[model samples]
Target: MPSWDNTPSGTMTAAALSLPGAQPPSKCFTIENYYPKPTLPSQKWVLIKVKAAGLNRAELRGRNGDQPAPPEFGMFVDEFHPDPPKVLGEEFVGIVEEAGSETKFGKGDMCTGFIYGGGKAFDGAYAEYVICPAQRCFRLPETSLSWDVLGAITMSMWTAYGSLFEAAQLAKGATALIHGATSSVGVWAVLLARDHGCTVIATTRKKDKVAKLKSIGADHVVLEDELKEQLKRLAPKGVDCLLELAGPDTIQTLALPNLAKYGSVVVTGVLTKQWSMKDFTPALIPPTRKMTFYSLEPGQEDIEGVESVIADVISRVESGTFRSEMFLDKTFPLERIGEAHGYMEENKAIGKVVVTVP
Candidate 1:
């Protein structure tokens, strides 16, 4: 088996949080070099030389101590240790530096995937190297897409795919409403829905992003305040599917009432930072409408299911059906991850903010 002895370093620098609270974004993180390079625990794992890692809201929640306790059925329970000084990142794209005998990946293959217990049970992609289960990783297609672009898309695209197709069963010719349309996942949802032949109506809080959203293939782009009025005009029968990414703030006020009689609302993201809805009741949902939640958590699906969804997304990108470059908002070096998190918290980014590892 290949070993870290062959690599350039015995230890690596990683962004870690020693304390979790509402501290300054930069203050919450520290670059540490004392941690030893992680070894593959078993043949089912691979060691990656990470080139780029994607920033996610979940990490921010972790830093703020806002993440809820793991569910009883959580698959990573055995590995999880949410103590301070944890590395924080969920998605990455990199070269397979070392692969186990049982895995299909080999040295030098480009790969991208999500880490379910990243920053907790396992060291995350915020470092120069990360260990991932072979089953959770996907080989990237031979394409011209940049590493940052690939990193940006992995988790966001996976979430969008699961919400649109797996959860909602969105069909061709359906009218889809993407709430929080300027978010990275929302952007991917817009593209996926449009590619699937749905008439997409995207909503954004900022008026400045309207043109950008429309250019990316949204049939209509409306401000959140104007959603109902515009939807009435554009999708009079109500939308066939609603992707609620803004979370509790918009779910009752905007998402539910605008759904078609038989529409499905898939809650895929919580851009608002509000975890629960105020006074939410069963009566909020109409009789014929359905509401569901989709997450890329472990145990949600099998390895084959994850591989299939990622492959479908990659195939679309390779075929030019989805423009990978259109989804990247910014790239920050690992040293500047705090600034990247700040940017995301400000809601200033139109798409994914990626952190590149040196």
Candidate 2:
């Protein structure tokens, strides 16, 4: 067990939200001292000294007070209530400062993973130290990647993996359409699809990102308006898989119509901030096609499977199959977290936005 006596300070700095969804990003957070440094909550939880933390759209939704409610029937019931003043980063890469008696990790082991209600349910990675359940943490492999790059990957990459392989059942030769291609998860989805031997068609609202998406291994990059026409020419048989990140705004009109006879659509992230379709019905879905939602809520039965996906991601990065550098869009010091949130809210970033903790 690590001794708290040797620790430098009992207080840590963090960006906290006292009132969510009431103010702009610039005015939403308050950086101040958080006292009595967080301790291990259980024998299965580890304390992490955060090196770098990644931002997610979920945090934005939390800050804006517009997050979708958890599914009523799953393990997520009552699992997502975020009580502020709270810390809000969902993913991070860091060094283990203290390990639980039952954990496989030890002090100084580099680690990264997701925290379910990070910022809302508890203090998150925005601080110098954060607590994570041992089962949710992944021991990172030896690599040359910087902390910021690794920090930007965890949650987004995991979501992409779950959506493509687990939820959508993407095949090696499938044609994958990644809507909202410039978002962090969208970028990873594109790369993962290409690496898995699929032809990737990525879509973005802006014309400038077309080249960036294509350069990242997308076989075809089309504007949202041009997707219908481009798909007719690129894949007349229709796409085999669709990773819908844009949510209700485009899923019905743009996504479902472009699917192959037996294609699957995985609705993962709601980037548009719209929760439900007005007057939705099962009849809207085409016959023989399927749609599902994907989420990585804590305490799910399949939580153990995260370790394998993390290992696969790190292995690909180490073997040079996945380009880790292309995923980082910007980095901010922990003090500039408000700016980071603002950047993501404005859609100014192409990939992941991370915060480096000193």
Candidate 3:
């Protein structure tokens, strides 16, 4: 019989799983409940007994029927061998139930990595069981690493690290402007930039989020709509760097004439509102004036650099110094998955809304 455990750091990753007499694989959440069928064992795969997983906005895109199901073994199986519908999930921490022949992971190991999107392209952490590759799995430190905490940081940390180091190349004491300061990455960016000695000016559309942002160590938090006035208050010299999570829509805001000489803006969103700057002249806000559209896709431009820095971020998380409850405002049981999505859609959450798998 398939078995499970709830002790997050224990041998079992799943709080539940198939038993010998249990019915065939079937999904528990969402509109489409595909039955689980047999999945092929891979030379490079590991079976994770999921304990908990964190939610990201990317998963919402898939849930809205926008993206393809996560790359399952079936897709690769057709290219490699035949497999069945795989579970979908992204950021999760669980015990390794099985490891491939050449894997660095072993049975009973606790690890966390990107699950992609749960219930959409991938069978995410909403379920008790999940399968992944050893290469994609990053091990949790033996000490002080809690499952919930690990799940919380993987995605946000990766996004923040990639933007700060790879895209913005943030320098110590640089003046930074962060939009959506109350969001998970926004809060993290504020804290991280501070660690580097940067002075930050942040923004939020809702005024009530001010105290929350300040609690997380923000230098300043202003309403999103007040950019004109807020920009004045932040000093007319503009900023040395801007982190734009507001997406394509707000790109024009960074073009404000107030930006400092050679300032940079690193972006990672798809919102439709936008800002435009007309000066294309090399002498003016030149193309040499940097702008980066940050995406966390796993590839050569990021591959090694993203992993190493995330490892460092995880180390900080392990130490508890980098822990930010700012993103963990709400949580749901695996069954309340629908409500969780709705809560996020309402935009009522100040930080992160996570799902507990147990």
Q: Pick the candidate with the highest TM-score.
A: 2
Write the residue-wise lDDT of candidate 2 on 200-246 in tens digits: 99999998888889888999898988888988999898889999998
- Lowest-sum lDDT 10-residue window in model 3: 1-10
Worst 10-residue stretch by lDDT in candidate 2? 1-10
Q: What is the lDDT of residue 155 in candidate 3?
A: 69
TM-score each candidate: 0.87, 0.88, 0.76
Instruction: Write model 3 residue lDDT over 198-238, tens digit each, in one string.
Output: 88888888888888878777787888778778787775877
Judge candidate 3 against the unseen true structure and give its global Cα lDDT, from 0 to 1.
Answer: 0.61
Please give the TM-score that candidate 1 achieves against the real structure. Answer: 0.87
Q: How accurate locally is residue 31 in candidate 1, as Cα lDDT from 0 to 100?
A: 84
lDDT of each: 0.80, 0.80, 0.61
Give the clashing residue pairs of candidate 2, or none.
87-119, 88-119
Greater TM-score among 2 and 3 belongs to 2
| lDDT preference between candidates 2 and 3, better one | 2
lDDT value, residue 21 of candidate 3? 18
